[model samples]
Target: MAFFGIFALIPLVGVVYFSMVKWNGMGTPQWVGFDNWSASLTDKTTLNAIKLSLIVMVVTWGVQTPISLLLGVFMAGRQRYRAVLSVLYFLPLLFSSAAIGIIFKSMVDPNFGLFSHIPVRWLQQSYLSPTLALPTVMFVITWAFVPFHSLLYQAGVRQIPQTMYEAAMIDGASPWKQFWSITIPQLKYTIVTSSTLQLVGALTYFDLFYVMTQGGPGDATRILPLHMYITGFKSFDYGRSAVISVILAVVGLTLSLTLNKLSGTGKMESQQEGI
Candidate 1:
């Protein structure tokens, strides 16, 4: 808690303070009150970035979460070659985001790359197309992060007692019914935790976009973090960048709390503590 306060809490307070000022990050900051926040709220580029981030968040939660849950369930079930499959599933998580992005970029390169012979221009032009850019980036993000979420779900699944499954089987419960009634209810806490992590990650995603697309072609994939980076370093508008940071922090916190409440994790934790 002391370390968290010193490192995380202090920096967060600094960010909030800086957001209310006009600073270029070098000289003394000028107090501009709510000007920076007002400007950030109305900025078209920032708004677009927020929209793209939200799209990534929704797509990740919708597509990646279910897939991870299913993979976790499958891996947790009795199966041959489970160890090898687990290693394969976890291999992607070992790679750095930059490395993954660069490898995928090269693989999808239009010419002289792995998919060069494929006649389709999905990578060449369509990846940068307005309609496809966000989805393409979302796919890459999902591919990179799904392994971690799957591991979380796998742990959750392993915690379930095998006797429950045996009883369900004896009670004539089909696999699908058991899954829906038993597996999902038991995994609620894991689902909430995984979704919160993914949501926060998606909102502040930067490295993948930086290495792969650099928020182009024409800002199609410019998430809020990328926008903040550009405003702070490239444009030297630190105050506005700080504003974006504060916004992201608030949004992430609110959504995470809401998810916990809706998933009943908070109540479950309290009940467990009481017991």
Candidate 2:
């Protein structure tokens, strides 16, 4: 507890300290009052970056969760080589973001990549134009994270007592009916947990976008973390970077609390605890 307390406190202290100063990562930080926060709010680039980040989060929620849940359900009942298949699906998540990004970039190459064989000019066609870049990034992230989400839902599905399925079966419940009545309710916690995890990841994602688009095609794919990185490292605007960091932290915390409140897990856990 003591170690965790100290470690957690360090970030809070740094946020407060840097948020009030103008530091160029050199000699010393100079107190700049609330200039950082004020400037960050008004800076067009930062504002645009925040917008892009929100877009990625929304797209991930829409595209990734449903597919993962479906795959989880499909894999849960099958007796065939489930472990091997799960591992194969999860391979993408095991690679470092840099490595994955480089591979994807190469694979999407127009001149000498498999994507070009589609009879369409995918890579050079600006399929990831300003309006499409963030969505494309969201697709890539979904592909990367979906397997882990499937594992999560699979675990939840596996935990539902076989007796429940037997009972459902004896009652003449069809597979779809059993799924809607039993599987979903039992896996509620897993759904909530995985959605929350994806939300947090999308809210702060940087690597895939940074490597693939570099938030390119004109700031279309720029997310908050990447914006903060560019501000501090690329532009030496530490104060503004610190402000963005604080905002990112606040957004993450707020969404986490919101997700927890909606999870229904708290009520269930409390009831179980009371018994």
| Predicted structure 2: clash tally | 0
Count clashes in each candidate, considering only residues at least 3 apart in sequence or on different chains: 0, 0
lDDT of 2 by residue, 40-129 (tens): 899899999888778777878778888988889877866678767876887887787777777867775656666566775444544456
Maximum-TM-score candidate:
1
Q: Candidate 2 — which pairs collide? A: none
Error of 2 at 76 (Å): 1.8
TM-score of each: 0.84, 0.83
Across residues 1-275, which tens digit of lDDT does each residue of candidate 1 receive? 79877888877989876754433442227777778888888999999998888888788889999999999987886677886798898988878888888887777665666656766655355454666767777788888888888988999999999999999999999999999999999998888888878876777678888898888888888888899999888998888888887787678778767777798656422110000
Local error of candidate 2 at residue 41 (angstroms):
1.2
Each candidate: RMSD: 5.8, 6.0
Judge candidate 1 at residue 191 and give its lDDT.
87
Please list the residue runs of candidate 2 whose C-alpha ends up more than 4 Å from where it truly belongs after superposition. Answer: 1-28, 120-124, 264-275
Q: What lDDT score belongs to each candidate, Candidate 1 first?
A: 0.79, 0.76
